[model samples]
Structure formats: C-alpha cells, structure tokens
Target chain A: MSDMSLATPRAYRRPSTRRIQVLALLTALVAGLILLTLSCGRGCLAPGDVFAALTGAPGADASFVVSELRLPRAVLGLVAGLSFGLGGVAFQVMLRNPLASPDIIGISASAGAAAVFAIVILSVDGWLVSLIAVVAGLGVALLIWTLSARRGAAGARLILIGIGISAMLDSITSYVLLEAPAWDRAEALRWLTGSLNGAQLTQAIPVAGALLIFGGLLAFTARDLEALRLGDDTAQALGVRADGTRLRVTLAAVGLVAIATAATGPIAFVAFLSGPIAARLLPGAKGLLLGAALVGAFLVIAGDFVGQFLLPARLPVGVVTGAVGAPFLLYLIIRANKNGGTL
Target chain B: MMRAERPHRFAGFAILLGLLVLTVGLSLTVGARAVPWDEVWAGLLGQIDSIGAAAVAVRVPRTALAVLAGGALGLAGAVMQGISRNPLADPGILGVNAGAALFVVIGIAWFDISGAQNFLWLGIAGAGLTAVFVYLVGATGQGGATPLKLTLAGTATSVAVSAFIIAVVLPRNDIAGSVQSWQVGGVGGARFDTLLPAVPFAVVGLLLSLASARVLNALALGEELATGLGQSVALGRLMAAAGAVVLCGTATALCGPIGFVGLVVPHLCRMIAGVDYKLVLPLSTLAGASMLGLSDVLGRVVARPNELDVGIVTAFVGAPFFIWTVRNNRMRGL
Candidate 1:
C-alpha cells in the first residue's frame, strides 16, 4: 500500500494544490455572479446603489428592487444552486456514474411533478408543496432503486429506468399544467422547468435549511464516498461501510434536490451540469461536493442574469442553463464513451 | 420451424386485428357523450341528424388519425429498435419526436409557415437532422453506438431542443396557447383535411417499414453474419432508418409528439410474435393502433367534461411497461 501510494505521489500532491486554487476560484466566481444578479433586472443598478439598497434604502425604488425583489431572488438562486450542485455531485460520486446525477436520473423530475401536482391539483401552497415534493422524490428514488437492482451494472440500469420514470413524471407535470386554470399556468410553468421569476424570501428558508442539514451530512460522508469509488471491497477493507455511505449520501442528496426543486422548479440541468464541470475543473480531486456546489450556484445566478438581461427576450433561468447544459451533456457523453463511460 | 410457427403467428395477428377493430368501436362509442351502439353504426353510415350521430361523425377522423399515427409511431419504433438492435430504441426515445417538434415550432414561429405540407416537411427535416446528429455522436465512439451511449446522446438532444422550444414559445403569447396544447400530443381537434396530408407520408413510411422487416431479420443475426448471407447491411439500415424518420416526423407533425406508443408496442409484440421482425413489425402496428385507440378512449372516459390528451394517457400507460422492460432485460450487449 505504501509503495502504491508512493508510485502515484503526484496524484495526491498536485490535486491538493489545485483543489484549493479551484475552489477559491469558484467561490469568487459565485460571488461575482450573485452581485451581477442583484444589480441587473429591468434596468441595471450601480454597485453603490445595490450595496446601499441592500443596507438600508427603505423607501427608495432601488431599495425595493434590490432588497425586496432581487435579494430574495439572489438568495433562492444561491441556496438552491448550491444544493443542486452538492446533491448532483454526491449522487454522481456515490453511483460512480457520471450520468447518474439526480436531475438526469428522475429525482428532480419527480420532485417537480409533485410540486406541480400539489399546486395545481391539490391547490396547496408553500411548505406543503415542498413537503410533497421531498416525499415524492424519495418515493421515486426508492422505486427506481428497487426496480433497477438486478445483477449487473446497477448504475447504468438506474439511469435507464430513471429516464423512463422521468418521462412519465414530466408528462404528469404537463398534464396538470394543461388542466390548470389559465391564471395558474403562468406560475405553473415554473414547475415544468425552473424559474426564479416571482422570487420570495420565504421560499428560501426551507431550501437553506435543507442545504445546511443535508449539505452537512454529505460533507461528513464525503471521505467514505471517495473511498467507495476505489471499489466496494477496498472501501470495506478500509473500514468504511459502503451501504451506510450510500444510504446517507442518497438521503442527503435527495433531500437537497427535492427542497431546491420545490423552491425554484427543477431549474433545468443545474444539478446535471454542476458536478461534471467541477470534475473538469479539479481533475483527480476526490471530494468535489463543495466545488460542485459553488459551480451550481454560479450557473444558476449567471443563468438567471443571462435570461433576464442578456437575451432580447426575458427567459427563465432554467432555459438558459438547459441551453448550456445540452451541449455539455453531448460533450460528456462523447468523452465518457471514449473513456468507456467513466469520467 | 417456419411451417409450425406460421399458424400461431397468423392467429396472433388475427387477434390483434380483432382488438384493433374493437378499439375503434370503443373509440367511436365511448366519450364525454356516450353514443348508443346502434347509433354508432348509423353515424358511420353518414346519418348525422342527431347529436349521437354527429358525435360519431366527429370521432371518425379522430379514430383514423389515432390508428394511423399510432401505427406510424409503432412501426417507426420497431424499425429503430431493429436497425439499432436495441430494444429501447423508439422515435421518441431516440430524439426523432423532439427533432420533429422543434422544427414545426420553429417553422410556425419564424417562417410563419402554415398548412400540413409545410409542417410535414419541416418536421421530417428536423427528425432527419437529429437522427443524423445522434448517430454521428453515438456511433463514433469505440464500441460504435452502444445502446446506453446512443440513448444518452438522444436524451441530451431532446432536453436541449425542448429548452429551445420553451425559449421560443414563452415570449409570444399569441402562439403560446396553441403551441402548448399541440405540445401535449392530442388527436382531439384532428380533421379530415388536416389529416389528409399525412396519409401519403404515412403510407410511404408504412410500405418502407414493412419492406425493411426482412432486412431487419437479416441484420439482427449480427452485421457480419448478415453480410455473409449476402445482405448489404448499410443500405438496409439506412432504408429502415429513413422509413422510421419519415413516419416519426409525420406522426409527430400530426399528433404533436406522442411518446411511448412506439417504445412499448414493439416490446409487447415481440412477446407475442417472438423475435421474428417480420411477424413483430405487423403485430406492433396493429397493437400500437389498439393501444393508442384505447388510450384516447380512456382519456375521454376518465376525465369527462375535460378530456385528457392521448399523449398524456400513453405516457402514463406506457411508463410502467418501460420500467418493467428495464428491470427484466440486461442493459449491456442487447
């Protein structure tokens, strides 16, 4: 083992340095994106005005736009984005399949479907919707888990089954939206894909709570998860319980994603894209949960800004991320195939 | 072996055709407003003096469209699965439906394109492009188009294309309502004139699909073996794929991207007809038509006063079967 460690010494030493640099860079990028989101909407606000408004511009128009409108929107984006990123990367790492992110594997789709059904059919509001989503999300994960547990590469089977499941869930969302009263459609559209358009500070609370609790659990298991990646037997030999780690990771990831999805719809591939980007940024790095979280936050905030201000027409943040994600998905598939489906 | 199997296959085909006829009858009679069985016969005979007869009159074109579109999608799916040699290959799963949808939406949005002819062309072009692109991306890897790789590529393309569609449709409220309903995949408002344009394409596609069954059987014995038996594997795959694309694009244009009719039908047919593509293809068409017709009838019956679309119904009905297939089959080397 010592000889093995010594032979690949550069793998450890090099990534340690790169991880710090990369995480720091991602943090800075996320911060910049948050600022950008806060400052721009219908009309761009100056940096001074944004800071001033955030501080105590109670009666001013800039203050309302910044504090009331933009602040909640930014907070939701930050929390939801981080959660999506963390959950996405954790699932990918746990499953050892790059394509097995929660968004692609029907977790987010089920959550979004639940949220839509709650809002449209049940006429539920706020936290109840999120609760339904989280439950439904876990239920779907369980269903897929039991269904795809045949002997073979469970990871590949999980993705295929998830695709089938997601198709059904997505169509449910559409059907609800279609049956939804005209007044509900504009809001229900967010459930089909994610959007931060009617941002509310209240919506961020449950999501942030999920982030803190689930995110903490994921961080605790990160080491064991990295060990499990080396192979289950090796992980077991190293005193790590593979099943325990998988269960914790699955719970945490599903919780994070369900809450985030309920708050801001599924947000279209933010969860799907974050982990791969983080992996690319810090190649050979083991624990990418934090880096992916930051990347997720960056993509959400930046995507929202692009949809709101960069494009001629105002679009949802999900649309922007979806556009970016599709090409990246293609690139990843081609690359993963070249490497025999291992990233 | 052939002699022994022929009787059973023919019996199975007869049953499916009988089911298809029953489904049409059910579709004609059962709806938000139920028509008497005797009245349905009169309605079919063009006596439209009463509401029941008029309702039956309304259902005639819808039933036809559903059958044709369902057959088209089911046949397309069988050909795709055959050519790709992957059970999961369907026009919807393989990005052809999405490709057709994106093109038709674009044509409506940008070119202000109208009429069935224009929609048909745009949809076919889009389906063809997506098919070619997915093939290039999926087939280029070391193993040449494995099922998993191709599926991933197709799913990604579908995801991306849909995002584009949402971006296009969101801003324009004028087109959004119409486009949104269309996207839900229904045969509700289907009319004879509007349905006519697709018949030619559907017939051509049907002929091509039926003709390719022998080629599919040949190709199914592994490419090298098929070639050894004097089959031009490339030509056969291309012709089959083209037929699938035309059928899928045409069906998508008419029905607005109904999924799973193709994916589930062929699998069910294979169970009934065995692995013989010749037997499976025709059975799939009949079975596909029956399934869609039943779905449409179920949609109308389940949600009275506010009918659900066949597309949504198929999705709900087919998804369980899809999960079952995944669980039962091996994902590798199939």
Candidate 2:
C-alpha cells in the first residue's frame, strides 16, 4: 500500500516472528512481576488467596491488601509502565535517537516541577496536582519542541536543550521544596522520588484511561510512525505528511507520559531504559511500541518489587529504576561509541 | 584578526575584574535590609554603630564566599571544557559535584563527620574518582571520549550517584532534614571562619589552571593536532582535569554543587576573550566571580526577606543562556 516502503530500513519494514516472540515473552514477564508485586508484601498471600481476593472472596485482610492497596498499585505499575514504554519508543523512533525519552527530554521534569509548585507553593494536595502536571507537561514539551526546532530537530540539539530546561526546572522545584514548611519536606521528597506506596484507584483510573485513549490513537497512527522512521524527506515524498505525523505522535506520546508521570511522579529512567532494552531483546524488531511498553511495565513492577522487598530498607520504585537504569544508560553510550554510531 | 586581538585580551580581564568589584558592592549594599553606601563603607572599616553594621557584617562574608566559590567554579568549568574539548563540559555536568555530594553525605551520615574542612577532603576524593570513572567510560570504544559520549557518561554517572545518595539519605530523617540545604547548594551560611579554610585550595587550583593555559589552548585544536604541535595531549588533559577537580571539589564542599556557573561562565569568557585560553581562563575566573556574586544578590532581593540559594539562582540565570548557546552557536566539538 505504501510506495516508499522499500526506502524504509529493513528493521522498520515489518515485524518478524522473532519480534512477536519477544513481545510475548515480555508480556509473560510483566504478568509474573505483577503477581509477585501483589503477593510479596506482609502476610504474603498465597496465589490462591490472591486469586480469591480478586474474585470477591470476602476475607477482610486479603481483600484490603489486594483490592485497596496492592491492586491499585499493581494496576498503576502496569499502566504507567506501558505509557512510558510506548511514549519513550515513540519519541526515540520519531526523533531517530535512542536517548530521546520523555524523561530526558524535559516532559517528565516539567510535570514534576509543576506538581511540586502546586504542592509546595499553592499548598495543594491529592490528584489536583496530577491535573496541573499534565498541563505543565504538555506546555513544557511544546516549549522544548519549539525551541529545539529553531534550526532542525537534530537529536543532539534537542537533547541538550531538554537537559538545560530540566536542570532549570529541577532547581526551581528544589527551591520550592526547600522553602516549604519543614513538615512538608518528607511529602515533597516522596513525590520527587517517584513512589507507588499510597497508590489509590483514583490515581490509577485516570492513568489507565490515558493509556487506553493514547494507546489507541498511537495504534491508528502506526503507519505514519513507520513512515516517519524512513526520514523526513522520504516520508514526505511518500505522502506521509511528515510534520502532521510528528505532531500527532508528539501529542499522543506526551499525553501518554504526562498522565503516567502524574500518577507515578516521574519514575526515573524507565522511559529512558525500556526502548533500548526492547530493541536489544528483539534485535531486528522495528516499531518497538508493544515490546517497549511491555518491557516498561515489567521494569516498573520489578523495580517496585526490588525497592520494596529486595533491599534492606524499602525504597521507592523510582529509586530502584534510577539506580538500575543509569548503568544501562552508560552501557548504551559505550556500545554506541564502539559501534561508531552517532549517539 | 588574531594578532590585532592580543592587547584587548587583557582589557577583557580588566573589565571583568571591575564588574566583579561592583558586584561585591551590590551584594553588600542590597539584601533583605538595604544598607546605605556610607553604612556599608563604615561597616567594612569595623565601625559598629548601627543595625546596618550587623547586617553588613553577616552579608560581607557571604558575599566574599560567593566570590570565592563562583570564581573557583567558573575556573573549574573553564578548565573542564578546555580539557574535555566539549562545550557542554562543567564540573556539575560531568558528575563531579554529584560525586562530591555523595561522598560528603556519606561522611556526614556514616563517619559522624561534620564541617566544611572534612567535606573538602571527601569532595576532592569523590570528584577525582568520578572524573576518572566518567573519562574511562566515555574514552573507551572507538572514538576515545567524544563530547557526546562524555556528556552522556557524565549525566549517567551523576544520576547513578544521586540515586545512591537518596537511597542513603531517605531513611534517616535527621540526615534528610539537615542535608537538604547542602543538597541544593547555598552560600547563605558563610562566615569569616568557615570561608577561610577553602581559600588555599581554591587559590592553588586557580594558579594551576592559569599556569597551564597554554596547554589548554593547544589541546583545544583537537588531540591529534595538539600532539602534532608538541603538546602531550594526555598529560595536558590530566593536568587540566586535576585542576578542575580540585577547584570544583572545593567549591562544592563550600557551597554544595552549584551547577551552570561553570557551564555558563566559560562561554561568556570565551566570547569576550576571543579563543585564547590565556585570556579565557582568567576572564572566566572574574566573570564567574562577578556572575555568582550578582546572582547571590539577585537571589536575596527577589524573594525579599526570604533568600533563595545561589545554586537555584544560577540555574535560573544560566539555563536560558545555555539554551541560547545551543540554539544559536555552531559549537566546536572536542
């Protein structure tokens, strides 16, 4: 159906059986991690008890832990992870750089800064901050897009500009937190260091809705994403409407991660880490949307598990992901250098 | 064009020095309580007659500390950029401050250590190790540490170190409460006694960087070119990096990881001093000092009665400048 399909990179042309196999495996892994997350706390409910609790088995303890606490948390882990994974890969593919995740590109940080501002300065609480986060996330992403697009969407330039903005926002957020009444310090810190400890259905529901809506939109625009991957001039020649596709992708991607960040408080490096790991897993896999999203889900769930149960003390999911993801980031840089590829 | 610009290089440094002196005056005279010029002058001469005198007494040391830390950071950033040949290079950008912060936190939490003096040693060790680690990681593989790789590696290292710091600090409420100010990097608490010890280290690092200005100049032309032109590129880089680490470590110890001062100051210096390292190095020192002093003053004035950290102020001031640099300039790759 596409005239310029031949010009697309071999990896981007179509997903092979191997890619499907990888995605299947990642889905399976995400399921396993979710089960582990649901059952691994306190009394450590047996799998049967967890299943019973899920199916309305009338036990107060199991139901409270599973339905009220762990269920929303597990659901959020899945939804937020999926959003970051998909959004990250979208940006990476559209920008044609592995490093251009929402985390690195000022989107998540903007949400964080805004949320912090709402909390510390305005003295707001609860899910209202999340709404502000989404607006701020979109606003910051738009600003970054405009600023970086001055000459061209060169990957390095975009990344550099994103970093500068993130740094500025981070400082402002920190100042607000520092100036806030001492009692609010712990709360601000928890928010800054992304956690799912008090995960409620209220937070998880909106994030899940965002994932479903944006995820559907991305699937429909899949052809444009593949076309844009072939390069702007070639995609334009192929009747792809390159800028339109970019705008659509950016809008959907930003919406996906903005909600996820609002829900999870910018889980560090899951968005940055998932795409490359997904690409590694499938090798020749192109259009890594599903694989990356699943991998992201797995990372968050697993990282949460590790943070809560694996360490001597309970740490936040963001802490574990950051600790784990940064090393992988360094490895990618090294490998890219070794391959003589422009990072 | 190069020959005609020789005499003007000194003029750039001269202008920066004058600006720095003016900034010092502003820092003293402008704050929560605005002291008149005569009161500030009288206070400086130890005439303790009025409420303004006490205010000036507290601000003078802070202003001086800002000058010292800012000059050190700016010089450190200049040297780091020159050595790495990466326009984006800054002590904070390259994980040096994060490294220093991590070690300082560890020293405070684990060893029951306190004071700027102990932090200085720990900061130096941590910064030195981080510099080596980032360089090794970035320099490995085919290209031997391109600007992109170094920046990426530096960023990764900083993230990793910061995560570890959080992991350590989060559990201890007492540590968390006290460490917040240090984490953000401020000079508000500077006193005459606290500011005295860091001076020697900053001065030594400054002299070392200034003395090696020629090596930095040659190395700026690329490693192979520098080598061909009778410079030991590796040795020059090592010396420059050492100087940077020391200066940055001292500043971070004294002021807690104020970033972007180093990152932004060098570019301003380069613009004024042309491409000559001999001029850029000294001009950066003055520019850094003046910029930080002014930023500290701005921080105090903006919030009015409540002060902002110099680190926060510098980011607000420097980030736009950094973004503009990226947008407008075709940066030279190291």
Candidate 3:
C-alpha cells in the first residue's frame, strides 16, 4: 500500500528429496547425541553402563541417573523439539515467510506469558500449565488473525501485527516474573529461558502425545501445505482448498507449539530454525515436515549438551538455541535481503 | 491527514499543551497515596511534614523523569518514522533499544560498569550501531527498507539480543538484579541525583531533533527530489537519526528502554498535526510526556501497594494501538 511492496516471494520445493539416507543420518546423529548426553554428566558413564541401565539390568549402578535424571530430560528435549520443528515449519510453509515462525509471531509468547501467569498468580502446576498454555497459544493466533485481517494483504501485515503483539506479551511475562512474590528459580527459569533442568518423565509423556496427535494432524495436511508454498492462487488452481488447508494447519501447528512450550518453555528458536535448517540439509525436499522435526530433535539434544558442558556456566537450552539461532537468522535475513527476499 | 491550516495548527498545539498540563497534574496528585491539593502544592515547595506531602515529594522526581524520558522517546520515534518513512519505525520496534541493552549489559557483565554517564555512552553507541545495522539489513536487495522488512529485521535482532542478555545475566547472580531493571524499564527508583546527569543530554538531543525539522521536511519529498532541491538526503537522514539515537539512548540509559511512547505518540501526533515533521516532532514530545506521566500515575494506582512499571503499562496500552495501526494501514514488504 505504501512504498514497500508485499509481493510474496515463493521458495521452490516439492516432495522431491535425497530421501531416506539423509533422514536416517539425521536420526542416527540425533540418537548419538542423546546417548552422549546420557553418558557425560557429573560422572561419565560408558555406553555399556547406559545400555544396561536402560534395559533394567541387575545391579545397575547409575540407574536413577540414567532412567530418571537424563532419560526424561532427553525424552522431553526430543519430543518438544519435534513439536517445535513440526509446528514451526508448518507456519513458515503456510505463510511463506520464515519470520512467521511461532516464536517470532507471538504464539510462543502467549504460551510463555500464560505459563508465567499460571505459576506466579494462580500458583498452578503440572498438566494445568500445559492446558493454559495450549489455550493461550490458540487464543493469540486468533487475536493476531482477527486484528491483521482487518487490512488488505494479510501476509506481511499479519507478521508485523504478530511482532507487535509478541512484544506486548513479552513485557507482561517479564513484569509478572519481576513481581513474583516467591522467587522460584526453576519456575522462573522455565518461563524465562526454556530449560530442561528439572524435566519429569511424566512431562515428556503429554508432550510426546501432543507431538503424535498434532504432528499427525500436520502430516495429513502435508501435501496441501506443499501446495501452499506455491502461493494461494496457484494452490487453488491446483484444487488445494487453500483456506481450509491454512486453518487446519494453523490450529494443529499452534497446538503443537503450545503443548511443547508448556512442557519446555518455548525452547527459543528451535521452532524458528528447524524448518530452514532441515530444508537446507535435505535440499529439494518437499514436505520438509519430517526432516525439520528431526532437526528440532537434534538441535535440542545437541543444544542442551552444549549448554550443559561447552559453556562457561551451565545455561538453558533456550539460551543456547537463541544464541545459535540469532546469528543464523541474521545470516538468512542478510542473504535474503541481498537476494531480494528469496531463501 | 492533510496539511494543517495556520489556525488548526495553533489549535492543535494549544490542545496538546493543555493535555500535557492536565496529565502532569494527574501525575503529581494521583498515586498510591491520595495527596490533597494543598499538600501537593506544599510538597512542590519542599515541605515534607505531612504523609501526603512526603508521598508527593517522592513522586516529584519520578514525574520529572517521566516527562523528560517520555518526551525524548516520543520525539525520537517521530524522527525515526520521518527519516525512514516507515510507520513501524519506533526505537523498541526497530531493535535500537535491544542494541543499547546489549552494550550496557556487556559493560555490566564484564567490566562491572556503574554510573549513569557510563551507561549513557554505551547505550548511545549501541543504539547508533544497531540502527545502522538494522537499516542496512532492511534496506538490502530490491525493496529497500520496506516497513515489513525493517520491522522483521528489527524483531529478529531484538529476539537474538534478548537471548544474549539472558545468557549473560543467568550465570551471574551479582549482575542479575541490576540488569533486570534494564530489561524492564521503570521510574520508580527515580532520584534527582541520578536524574541530573541525564538532563543536559536529553536537552541537547531534543534541540537537535527540533532544529532538524526543516531538513527532515525537505527529505520527505523523495531522496532525489530533496537532492534536486539542494538538500543532502544522506546527510539529513543521518543528522535526524543521530538526534533520535541520542534521545532514545539517553532515555534508555536513564529508564531502560520504554517501548510504545515513541511508536504511539508519533502516530497520534500525525493524526493531529499532519505529516509535517516540525509539527509532528513537537506534538509527539508533548503527547509522549503526557502519556507516560499519566501511565505512571495509573501504574501507581492500579496495583495499590505495589506499582507496575511504566514500561509494562505502555506495552499494555501501546501494543493494541500498534496492532490497530497495522490493521488500518495497507502495508507492503514481508
């Protein structure tokens, strides 16, 4: 409408992929990282010890450390990663804007804000946090959608509106945390930095189940999503029912993101990074859904490990991913700006 | 949105000044404690004998800081939009605040820097550098610094910077409390001693912005046309942006980064004073001060014993307004 043109640029992709080999390599690599996290902690354990601990072997010494401490945390990371990856890519694909990832746009902010409110004000815990986060995430999406839809060309407007909304929500989150009567370190850290320091095996269950249901929902619409990346007119011409596809995908993706955020506290930019990283890793791959999901898992396992060991002081996964993702995002923006907004 | 005739322009200024007077009054008298009018007057005269007088005394410097800082942010935001020709160009929205935060945070974490003057320079430097970086990044490729592109670039930078700050703060218990205020802006801790160092900087920045009004006007008519009219587009853009940076940098250094005053005030002023930078800039200053002063009062009153930060108050008020602006306007660039 003004000087800047919102001519939507399309990224080229299809179901075409390097296929199973790349996917297998990423899975195996992620598995190795998870195992590595299991082995190296306060005291190192051999792969032999880890294997026996997993199998409920007799006289397993580090069984609690393996099954309780490390195992649930790893499972939480892996499951939450998949949720973020799947959810993030779905939005980017549907919106055709990398910056439209849930984290940047305010869905994740809504969840984090809700989580903080629940913890500080309501003094709630467990599944209740998950429930509130999920509800808030969907509500924010609707809020952004309704507000942005008031104008012409909702694409760029939506993301910009979302950013504005996201800032507001973030301020609320910070304000509540600051005024929190009882300073709970873990509760504060979970909302502030997205940590896995106190992951419960119980927490992993609902998140994994969320990944399964919402991820499956996303997968069912995967083909239509591919058609979406080609833009709305072209997709409709190919009988893709663009609006229906967008609505369903958005709901499913928001659900995935909120549920995972409730469990892991919006693990900073995993959702933002996964799609683009996976697309690069498996070049020409359409429906980068599975690949991106796996990348999310890999990033969490690897990021948590780095935060735990590589850093000067042990940090949260969100902090590590945020630090890593920011530079990559800048690179993408710089390159895209140079290439006239192309990926 | 047409040019204001002479009479309407005069009326606009009068209305704005009157609004400022009202808000300043509200800020002085209304707070956690309801100070009577005579006591507020007595408090202004340095009498702190009564409880209401003492409460009024405590709020005076805070109110002063709110006015000055709010004016700086609002003026900065107007100049930002004027120079960039983007409606979305607020200090906070553009990630300049984040940049300032990054430098001040680094200074705190590594060097253990203290004092307002030290942070002022760091904040200005960071704000200036980030402004340049975001502009370059946004202005790259075919569409140069489109509103959407710039906003996105700023958003990404802000997100990245926040992560970095959290990382630095999380590990060290010592610096964490100090940085928390920087993360969340407020004037609750306002003191004249702290406020005094910032006044000269704020005045210079304010004058510099007001002085560049004609140059900003000339450049508004496309870069080449402004050059055709013997105006230096790059030089003018830089000068105006410098004033904005100084203003925002000083405000941020003083009160952390308060969002939305810069964003909301300029837009409101434009609605009142048209697109003319001279009218917009001054009007934004008054409106911003009024808004922040009133918000500070609201913050004090709303929660009773506890006070909400002015930054949080503005966020609640401004974000919806921002979203509304985005919705009503037809924007391009993704």
> Scoring each candidate complex against the real one, what DockQ results?
0.64, 0.59, 0.50
Which residue pairs overlap in candidate 3's backbone? A14-A286
Two-way DockQ contest, 1 vs 2, winner: 1
Q: Which stretches of candidate 3 lie above 4 Å from their native place?
A: A1-17, A150-154, A185-190, A231-240, A337-343, B331-334
**For model 2 chain A, the run of ten residues with the poorest summed lDDT:** A334-343
Chain A TM-score from candidate 2: 0.89
lDDT of each: 0.87, 0.83, 0.84
Put down candidate 3 lDDT per residue, B226-302, tens digits, no spaces: 88998877787788889999998888888887888899998888888888887888999999898889888889988
| Candidate 2 structure quality by residue, lDDT tens digits, B25-104 | 88888898888888888788878799898788788899989999999989999998888777888887788898998999
Which candidate comes out best when scored by lDDT?
1
Using TM-score as the measure, the top candidate is 1
In order, the candidates keep a fraction of the true contacts of 0.62, 0.68, 0.66
Candidate 1 residue-wise lDDT, B53-97, digit = tens = 989999999999999999998999899999988878878877889
Ranking by TM-score: 1, 3, 2
Candidate 1 docking classification = medium
| RMSD of model 1 against the true structure | 2.8
Whole-model lDDT, model 3:
0.84
Question: Docking quality tier of candidate 3?
Answer: medium
lDDT of 3 by residue, A28-77 (tens): 99888888888888779999999999999989998989998999989999
lDDT for position B235 in model 1: 91
TM-score of each: 0.95, 0.92, 0.94
